[model samples]
Target chain A: GAGVSQSPRYKVAKRGQDVALRCDPISGHVSLFWYQQALGQGPEFLTYFQNEAQLDKSGLPSDRFFAERPEGSVSTLKIQRTQQEDSAVYLCASRSGAGTDTQYFGPGTRLTVL
Target chain B: TQLLEQSPQFLSIQEGENLTVYCNSSSVFSSLQWYRQEPGEGPVLLVTVVTGGEVKKLKRLTFQFGDARKDSSLHITAAQPGDTGLYLCAGHNAGNNRKLIWGLGTSLAVNP
Candidate 1:
């Protein structure tokens, strides 16, 4: 598909378990973003990557949350020692450039912590 | 910190009904966008209003950006069952180049 795609569309993890979610953005897209959305809530920005450089991660909830976009294309978000509060849908989006506001989104990964 | 507040958190109406959802913020924005998300899927961009007081329409949906760039609204006319989804509003932080502040979405359910 030409649009962004996320892997492991659903994940179930136990407390303290670590999990990694993957995102494949549209080819040639330069900006990538990760967001966490709780049930009934809008997506909250977690981090942003401009090519291979992770430009902003201030929105990450904790140190346990980490993301990488090596090769400047596919990205991954890893959360260590997961907590129940971490249960939410993780969404990935990519924009054509840093100057544009339109973002193409992936299907999102729903993480359920128990 | 920038924040967007949406009103009428949840709305349920029969097909062909009309409704409006609002997103308000105290901080100004460079641009505002509206998205629609279905269950288990990410949001799809519906419209982006760049100029204040700009109005855009797509089929039965009409979007308006406040003149102050601090608020926006979405109005649907003769809504259809296919319109059932979560409607979200996001704004480009005027202070940040790429950061977007999002508002709690309005859950819309159109009964047929």
Candidate 2:
């Protein structure tokens, strides 16, 4: 599809198990964003990447959460030693450019930790 | 820290009913955007209000941006069953060129 796409529509991991979510953005998109959405809450910013550079990751909940957009296209969000609180939908979005660009979002990966 | 709060966290109404959802924040934003998300799918952009006191309409949905740029609202006229979904409001943080602060969405269920 022309819109952003994320892998593993649903994932269930045991506590302490690691999981990696993938996102494929629209072709030629310059900005990519990762968000965590807890049930009954909004999607909170986790990290942002402008091309291959990760400009902001201050929103990541913990050091175990890591993301990267290598080669400036597809991106990956890796969570180490997952916890029950990590259960949430992970959403990926991409924008065309810097300012005022409309964000196109993916179907999102729902991670369930047990 | 910037935070957006949405009212009526959950709403249930019959088709053809009218409803309004509100989003408020103390922080000023350069732009405010509305999105609709279905279960298991990501949000789709509905509208973006940049100018203060600006009002934009999309079909039965009308969006308004507050004069202070710290709040916005979405009003639906004669809502339909198809309109059942989570409505989200997001405001752009000028400090972060590409980041948007999101409000906890209002989940609306329209029964036919």
Candidate 3:
């Protein structure tokens, strides 16, 4: 793909429902990141992956948040028992290698828990 | 924890006016990057400053990294409506880790 792509641009889920958001990073990119951005706030790091190896999950808010990059090219962020507070835009970004490489971001999935 | 704080959470100015947004941190960084985001879209990288005391210019926009590598600023000269967006600053710690700490971001609105 020309750029990072996310699925379900907009989603509305009832409280307690589980939802999954997907991201397709740029071809052959080695680094992948997931972030959550609340209304009127900047994106907060959620997790990071280095070639299918989940190196960093320190930013995941709680047990309900889980992310995986099985093949290192596409990733999924799953939220279990979603709450009203879970409503936010989920963003995915990718970088080529490591140090100082620029990160390209996806359009993001806007999740609305009603 | 290393944190980046951005000033003027929101700014509205007339076209042709000049403005500057700042990002500050207490910890030093190896590199800092500036990004601009529009509504319904993800942020796009605008510039990256690696060396302390470095200054980079992108047409009407100018970016500077602090001498101590703990702060940075973005200045726009003769702003235009096209420049209206959310500006964010992110920095990588010097520990060789790839994690980036992001600022709160400055939302700028340039009205024509």
lDDT of 1 by residue, A28-78 (tens): 999999999999899999999999999999899999999999899999999
- Give the DockQ-based CAPRI class for model 3: medium
Report, in order, each candidate's fnat: 0.84, 0.86, 0.64
DockQ of 1: 0.85
For model 3, how does the per-residue alpha-carbon lDDT over B2-111 read when each residue is reduced to its tens digit?
Answer: 89999999999999999999999999999999999999999899999999999999999999999999999999999999999999999999985567899989999999
**Cα lDDT for residue A90, candidate 1:** 98
Question: lDDT per model, in order?
Answer: 0.95, 0.93, 0.94
- The residue ranges of model 2 lying beyond 4 angstroms of the native Cα positions read none
Q: For residues B1-112, what per-residue lDDT tens digits would candidate 1 score against the true structure?
A: 7799998899999999999999999999899999999998999999999899999999999999999999999999999999999999999976676778999999999999
Please give the DockQ score of every candidate, comma-separated. 0.85, 0.85, 0.75
Q: DockQ: which candidate is best? A: 1
Q: Tens digits of per-residue lDDT for model 2 on A1-110?
A: 77899999999999999999999999999999999998867899999999999999988999999999989999999999999999999999999996777999999999
Ranking of predictions according to DockQ: 1, 2, 3
